[model samples]
Every structure is written in C-alpha cells, then in structure tokens.
Target: MTSTPPTRRREWLAPAGLIALSLVPVLSGAARLTQLSTGATITADNARFFDSPVPIVVHIVGSSVFLVLGALQFAPSLRRRRWHRIAGRVVAPAGLLAALSALWMTIFYEMPASVTGPGLSALRIVLATVMAGAIVAAFLAIRRGDVRTHSAWMTRAYAIGLGAGTQVLTFVPYTLAFGAPGPVLHTVLMAAGWGINLLVAEIVIRRRARAMSARRGRPAPASVVSAPLS
Candidate 1:
C-alpha cells in the first residue's frame, strides 16, 4: 500500500480540524455549568464539584473563551494582521483568568473521596502555575519589543492550556476499556496530554525561529541596493 502525501490544503485543514476537536471539551464543560447552577445532580464522578462550583465554573468559562479565541491566533493569515493585535489584548486576560481559576481549584477544592489521590491535583497546580507565569512573561516580552519571544512564550502557555482539551482524548478510551482510572493512571494520562501539546508547540516555535533567522540573514537585493556610486 502507498502512503498518501500531504498538501497545502491538508496542512490548513489539519489546524481547522484540531481547533474544532479542541472545542469539544470547552463546550461540554460549558453545558455542565447550567446543570451546576440549577443544582441538578451530577454523576458520581463529579459529586465533589457541587461542594465548590464557582472555581470550576470560572475555569470552564474563562478557558472556553481563551481556547476559542486563542485558536484564531494560530492562523497564519491572522497572526500578522491588526486583528491579531486586538485579539491578543483580550486573550491575555482570558488566559490569565483561566489559569488562576485552575490554580484556585487545585489548591482549594476538596477532591472526591472516591478518588482523593494527589496525582491530578498536583498536575493541575503545576500546569496552572507555569501557564500563569508564561502569560506574564509573554506580556513582559511584548512590552520590551521582543515580538518573537512574546509569541514563543504565548505559544507555550496556550499549549499548557490545551491540556484540558487533550484530556478527553487521553482518558476516555482507557476509562471505557477498563473502567475509571486510579490515581497513578489518571496522572499519567493527564501528563501525556500536556507533554504531547508542549512537544508540538516546541517544534513549531523552533521552526518559526529558524524561518525568522533566515529572513533576517538574507542579503539585500542588488536591485534594491542600486549602484553605490554615481
């Protein structure tokens, strides 16, 4: 059998598909908020959430806004435009709120007695803290006129934020195959979500850096330079 080759359209299509898939978790989480607000009975897996729903609600809503709006920033057609500049202004606050909300839930929410292991909790804490730090670093880099550094940092932070979206892919199959995972297994799955996204982001960042470097190193065109002397 022959393997199919990639094309430019496919390259653009891939991000569109990924952006759609990533929205699944955000939309699902948003739907759940109505249930929470109405005091409807959530499943056993989510019972503990009722004890403290505000943080979770804030996280989901803020993250939903960040994820949806942030996806647009990755579009090459948009990144160099004025719209990107305006979007960045809004994306920062949305991302920061999401990260801070996750931190609050990790630090303060009581885990369900059924799955009280520190595995997921610890992972959330670290990711939230790093994401928040990255957001601030991006801001500082931009303020210093280091657009490249700012973009790279923002990319990394967005990757970390994508972890929650990736969790559905990582956990659902295993949970279906063998029932809900224990603490260690759950931790491993969640870590994979972050690892996979961060790895991809690093690759893109390096590629962009190389491209930018080449552009800067290119010699001026002879036509543009013209004759030095009359």
Candidate 2:
C-alpha cells in the first residue's frame, strides 16, 4: 500500500476544511437566524423589492442552478468533457442572474442601516462583480485551452458564489466569541468569510502547482544551459 505524498496531503487540506466548515451552520442551527420569525434577519424596508414575487422567483431558481453547477467544479472527471461544457452554459447565465438578483435584493432590503451602510453595500457590490468576473475569466480561459488557469479561476469564482454558506459559518463562531450585536462584528465576520474563501482557492492553486512541479521534477536552471555551437 502506497502512502500519499506530502503534496497530495496538503492539497486535500483546504477542501476538507471547507467541507467541514460548510456544515457548521446546519449543525449549529445558525441557519434558523435567517427565518422571518427569528427577528434577526437582514432585509430592506423596500417591501416592493424584498417582497416582490418576480425577484424572489429569480433568486430561488438562479441560486439553485448556481449551487448545482458550483458543486460540479469539485469533480475532476465531470469537469473534463462535453458535459462540463453543457454545464458551463447553464452555470454562466444562472450565476449572473443569481448575482444580479442578490445585488438587487441587497439594495432594496434594509438591515440595520448601520450594518448595511455604504461601506457594506460597496463590499457586496465588489463581491458580486468579482464573482461575475471569475465566471467570465473561467469561460475565456477554457476557450483558450488553458485548463490550469481555467480551473484556478473557476474555483475562486465558485468559492465566492458559495459564500452565503461561508458567511453563516463565520457568524456562529463570531457570535459566540463576541456576543454578536454590533454592526462592526457582523461586517468584520462577513469580510473575513469572503477572505477565507479566496485564501482557500489560492492555497489550492498553489498546492496544485507544487504537486505538478514535483511530478515533473524541477527544470534545470536556464543559467546552466549550454548554447549550441554557433
């Protein structure tokens, strides 16, 4: 029986951490906070937008589609063929709709104006923009046949897209540690959650690079290369 290499071990760490972290909200019962009766929910007072039937329908459908496609990113075989292409077709449009709907929802929905202040709004817009950009970059990279770049960008994008889960995970520990009440605590936690996801993606990409380099053996230094006789 062969033991896994150190590089493979390192590569597994982030996804394993994310998978475990993703379960915290459900296990801790933190998701209940989002319910209407929880009295801890975030929403805008613009009932026309928050309570609008059309946006809600779009939000549900788009988010569901994005979640399914995002999960497929973790499956290497599924990401390698025509099926991946078909999935991409579905993912791109759905993801865009999800992001747009979410942005709109955030705008119309009121939280503690202190919590949803201009800075927080800006951060949400930035996250949404980055999410959209990542999807576009992933599609373009694949079209150019740069699979490594494609995978890296897509993973980052999907990670950001799945950030609602990360946010919930962050809130539980933060609330426990700080006794959550202040807007500052919530803002800090949300930012930290997105930061953690981005960091995880970066770590995964770097580990993959290291593993590939190890598999190929480090190339001889250019300074050591002898020129052909002129």
Candidate 3:
C-alpha cells in the first residue's frame, strides 16, 4: 500500500469533480467557435464576444488543458512512473497563458453578462497576478528539485484557474431562483468563486498533510506539493 504523503484517490476525486463542473463553461466556449465557423448571425453578447474573443478563447482552451491534465497528475501509478513531471511541463505554461489572457480580457474587453466596475476590475487584476505568481513559483520550485513547494504552489494556481468551475456552483443557483444577477451580485458571486476554490485547496492541502503524518508516522513536508486537485 502507498504511504499517505499524497494518497492518489482522495486527491483525484476533487479534481474529477472540478473537471466535470468545468465542462459547462468548456462546452459553451466551444460553441462559440462553432458559431464563428458557420457564419451564424452574431448579435447581442455574441457580437461583443467576437469583437475581442482571442483572449477568452485562449483562456478557455488553456484552462481546459491545465485543469484536466493537472488532475491526472494525482494518479499514483502515473506519478510514480514520472508522467506527472511530463504533464507538469505542459500544464505550467498553459496555466500562465490562461492567466495572461484573463488579465488582457479583464483590462480591455468588457464582458456583457457581467460587470467590470472598479471593485471587480481590481479583484480580477489581483487574482490574475496571484495566479501568475503561483505558476512561476511552481515552475521555479520544481527546477530546484523542490517537489513539495512545487505541488503547493501549483495547487494554488490550479485553484484560481478552477474558479470558472466553482462559479457555476456558487452563482447559478441565484439565476435559477430569481433571474439574471445584477452587476453587484455578479461581482460578489464571482469573487466568492475564487475565494471558495482557494479555501478548498487549503483544506485539501491540510487534510493530506495530516493523513501523511498518520501514515508515515511523521508530518508531510511543510510545503509539499499538493495533490492535483488544483
């Protein structure tokens, strides 16, 4: 049996759920491409989306790759076989591109379904910055052979990237209950999305650490790389 430094199954479950939830946005994003290819009439928000769609598209594609492939890294068989390292190389850059594109979209393009007032704009900037930093730190830590730190930082970045998935859980209930959310509610809910994911990441991280301690009779490294949940 595997020691619990990172029990693969428990780590796998979280990202599996996240990936499943994220499909909602991924399918919507793909439809945008289909509509573009077929010369469908672009009206309303569709028109705005096309006006500056590159960044959003990049973000969608990049995050899909990052989130899905990153989850696979938690498989003990794959991780032991060194597939985790190979996947991390791709995931790291994809995450960075997603963050950069998100930053660009947040700065220049105005999303119609949501508001980008000063408060929300600032929130986006800060989150994007944190995401970027996390990616860089993960990359650097691995280069130094610090798998523990790399995992933790990668989890942090992945949590932020997974906010799209969490937002469905957080914000959609309101739309179902009432109607479309106003700008304030939208901003508040979106912020909650990132907060919730990060909070989940921390909980998972700590839980794994405790489990590792029990299984190994010693604590996991202070900054062990988190399971691929993020």
Clashes of each: 0, 4, 4
Local error of candidate 1 at 5, Å? 18
What tens digits encode model 2's per-residue C-alpha lDDT throughout 186-227?
677788778887787777666655665577798432211221
Task: Rank all candidate structures by their lDDT, best first, as comma-separated numbers.
Answer: 1, 3, 2
The count of backbone overlaps in candidate 1 is 0
Q: Any runs in candidate 1 off by more than 4 Å, and if so which?
A: 1-11, 42-48, 113-118, 218-230
Whichever of 1 and 2 has more TM-score, that candidate is 1
**Candidate 3 ranges with C-alpha deviation above 4 Å:** 1-12, 113-118, 212-230
How many clashing residue pairs, candidate 2? 4
Better of 2 and 3 by lDDT: 3
Model 1 Cα lDDT, one tens digit per residue, 45-125 = 677578778788888878887887888887776787899889999889889999999899778876664644547787788
Candidate 2 Cα errors over 4 Å, as ranges: 1-50, 108-118, 212-230
Models ranked on TM-score: 3, 1, 2
Cα TM-score of candidate 2: 0.69
Query: Could you give the C-alpha RMSD of every candidate to the true structure, in order shown?
Result: 9.3, 8.4, 4.7
